[model samples]
Target: MLRLYESSGRKISARIALGWEPSEVFECNLLEEDRCPVSIQGNEINAAFGAYEIKSYYLRK
Candidate 1:
């Protein structure tokens, strides 16, 4: 599980490196209601975050 937090009061872009390629990626939420699929390019995940936003991702090999 990888968690990202944007504490800055501005939108930001990020690139997360997992080192290894993941076969599947899912976006995790607090409610755990549904597992939203996330796109992975190579061994990295690129995302944009809003101010004070928090995001969690689950990667599976």
Candidate 2:
């Protein structure tokens, strides 16, 4: 599963195993570094492509 941490170490973000795995990390996404989980935040997970921000209040999928 992918562990999304905030820029600062003061807080942790999310654990995503969102039922999708690719061949490589660089070919997938910046946030998509490891294996995705089978259970994310359902519909509350938000993702930004280029920017490093996941979210201030919610964990991403």
Candidate 3:
């Protein structure tokens, strides 16, 4: 899991990939708390090439 946060400490988002599944997509509100259960919203993302494919998102300030 990759954690992303805003500079003002207001919002956060995490990215994680489990295997190569073309049918999977996700999104969610950025959460700072580690112990709390985080809920993520699902969005459309695409990946090509098989095996250990890396997916990344960029956070803009």
On lDDT, the leading prediction is: 1
The TM-scores of all predictions, comma-separated, are: 0.87, 0.22, 0.20
The models' CA-based lDDT, in order, is 0.88, 0.37, 0.33
Error of model 3, residue 12, in angstroms: 9.2
- Candidate 2 deviates by what RMSD? 10.2
Q: How close to the true structure is residue 1 of candidate 2, measured as C-alpha lDDT?
A: 28
Clash total of candidate 2: 5
Ranking by lDDT: 1, 2, 3
* Ten residues in sequence with the least summed lDDT for candidate 3: 52-61
lDDT of 2 by residue, 1-61 (tens): 2434356534444443445433332222355444343333443343433234443222232
Better of 1 and 2 by lDDT: 1
- Order candidates by TM-score, high to low: 1, 2, 3
Model 1 lDDT tens row, 1-61? 7888999889999999987999998998965547899899989999999999988888899
What stretches of model 3 exceed 4 Å from their correct place?
8-34, 44-61
